[model samples]
Target: MALQNGFVRKEGIPPKSRSRRPAPDRRYERLLARQGLAPTAGVDEVGRGSLAGPLVAAAVILPLRIRLHPWLDDSKRLDSRRRLSVCDWLVGLPGVAYGIGFASVEEIDRWNVLGATMLAMSRAVLALAEKPGVVLVDGREAPPLEMPVRAIVGGDRRCASIAAASVLAKVTRDRWMTEVGRDHPRFGFARHKGYGTDDHWEALRRYGPTPLHRRSFLGRLSEEAIPHLPWDDGAIEPRGGP
Candidate 1:
């Protein structure tokens, strides 16, 4: 079989790739489990850097020891089909508990992306029927959760629960933006998933921002040509720049 780009690219995710990161594992989970955090949940957020749409987060608690996708790592590392497949498996998988939460564009403008991300993560954790013993957050900053929080840099790639959460949050947000794309076909939200893509920028330049756009994000990322752009939403300290 002819290998494409040093690996066989297939309809679903293949075992190998041109470049590969270490797949997510249960190392952190075991470490924490030994420390008495039996039910540890992983929390991850997506769409933080988007120019439009809501910021979403997901919390997932998996069984102490179980085998999942051999290729599971970060949601960003997977194709759409594999991510959705893993998401479905995680959701339906026995002994897995998860929750999803969102912060609207208004909230992002109001609290700043960092603050809004913390808010979304907190909401995701709280959305669960029963809180876990501890939370393993994907980033260095921990969310304001009632339970213990252990923030790990690149937890999504190093932690199984966090990887699951990442996939769930990403799929949820992507589907949401795709639906919005139906109503506003010009912005190509479906294609870019609300990222600051070139097509998205051109659309914004021609049609202006929709209700879904973050005014603060636009003012920071775009040129001054757009008239009446909200430079500062007055919700938070104006953060980020060109």
Candidate 2:
């Protein structure tokens, strides 16, 4: 397979002979073009399924004429070092802008993961200093935004702007977990970034649940087996004294 124009083409196809395949996300491009928008923001979220840590959302606005990076793709498809490097480059770009937002564990418990994820995305879009004319979001549902919105299923894989957002969110959240790991070293947050990996599960069993763990999620587990480990209820109590 040979790469061309943000897609992989078969080896035998000559560039001149092959009919140009429509751009994977041309609908979004056409929408922006129709509106005469120079910077179209793409938004995505990470850590929605984590048993610990906050849900992180990122919104990225890329210049309309961005040249595709060879390594750019969905964040899940890239390894850690490459994702971090790309994220740094993306943040420093002249015409690009990005921001991150997070929903805390308590918010996740109250609103549930999907709702909290959307809330985080909305906050990220709002955090941008320069307002975007139109926002493109990864996945099938669009989070309500102050500006126009379009949600594309698999946008991260198909759209460069959305892919860049995914990288930013993933890298930012991973770095956050690593920093938190230093304080709570036993959880190994730096290693798994709060995902429900076997190591993370073992750590949970050993240390009970940390403040970062989603209490509502733990409540749904089999009580007979795991015992629903106790948390410091006083720490999470309402601010006013009882």
Candidate 3:
């Protein structure tokens, strides 16, 4: 069997060999093993830095018995097609369960990005049909949750479970942004997926900001005109109304 792009089994582990001992999965495998936990859920988030669109989180309970795709590194390391393929395989696994949650642009603006990200991650874990014994979160900071949680810095790259969660979260958010692009054609969200790419900035420059644009993020583009209710004599009038 071909290993996934970013991973190779440790030197002593033969290719296609299944051993009772836990394979050297990644940097965090020893940490998870030391916890005396057999089954743990990994959590990760995507789109935290986008100029538009919601922050998406995913929690995944991976099957400890089976061999995972070797290319299972951080989602950012994989291309879109590979990530989507891995996501579909993960979602279809019998022992695996996954849940997705989103914190909208409005929520991000209201609570600030970090808080909103934590909110989305918490929601994803809570939404799982069956909670795992331990939750492995991919980041330096632990989310505020009632469950016993372990936060791993660079966990998405260091932990297999967290990497799976990252792939799922990334694919889910990208698909959502593509759909949102259909409704708001001017933003070309399908191409840039709400990232502040040159294409996105050009679109913002040409067509102005959309409802999905993060107004707080527009300070750099301060000269650009953003869509908002024009105040008349210090009173804002509702659009298409008297």
Candidate 4:
């Protein structure tokens, strides 16, 4: 990964040995540290591509002396079990400060996904228990904030702090969706986590969109007309009345 014009540009990484897991680069942090940017935070968001659920962001400031877990990587690269394990361990580590922020479905609908994402990122940064001197966001764009920020395109894969943020965001959001699944078992929220999976598509067609489903996202599906009771704003509420 490289930084160009304030965006993190991503390039393919060479295949790693099968026996050993690849490690995220620490140079991004080191470079900042050299410039006296101690307590730099890495921020990342998850659920942007999902068809439903809130966009969640996490910001984490890792301590200089703490050794990161070897299994850490992009959250997408880890299984559900591993992600949960890593999230649990990361939150408990001493000198690790973190916070989570969410942009609701309503917010996404109102602001558009990009705007909502930035809002979520900003909230994550502000929610941090320990303030950071600088923020490293994983993507082509950085959220607008008063503090200094750098956008690393492949930060989740190339930067350890961003990878840690990814894990935290993913795990936290996944757990939320699982609880939502329990509330609305018919939609299989736990199974697909609100992504546009075939099962989710089928559910949409069969049962219509859930109350939490993104109305804008539904237009893109174009698979079937999402059933919306006239009073329900095109999304099916889980109430008993047809």
Q: Count the backbone clashes (under 3 Å) in each candidate.
A: 0, 0, 3, 1
The lDDT values for all models are 0.82, 0.78, 0.76, 0.83
What ranking emerges by lDDT with the best candidate at the front? 4, 1, 2, 3
Q: Worst lDDT window (10 residues) for model 4? A: 233-242
Cα lDDT tens digits, model 2, 71-170, are: 6768998898888777878887887778788888888988999899899899889878788888899988888776788898889888878888898888
lDDT of 4 at 46: 93
Q: Per-residue alpha-carbon lDDT of model 1 for 59-164, expressed as tens digits?
A: 9999976788765669999999999889888888787888888888888988999999999899889887667999999988998777889999989988999999
Give the per-residue lDDT digits (tens) of candidate 4, residues 82-172.
8878888898898898888888887888899999899989988998888898999999989888889999888899899999999999988
TM-score, candidate 3, is 0.80
Error of 4 at 105 (Å): 0.2
Best candidate according to TM-score:
4
Candidate 4 clash pair list: 8-153
lDDT, residue 112, candidate 1: 98
**Which of 2 and 4 is the better model by TM-score?**
4
Off-target runs (Cα >4 Å) in candidate 3 are: 1-38, 227-242
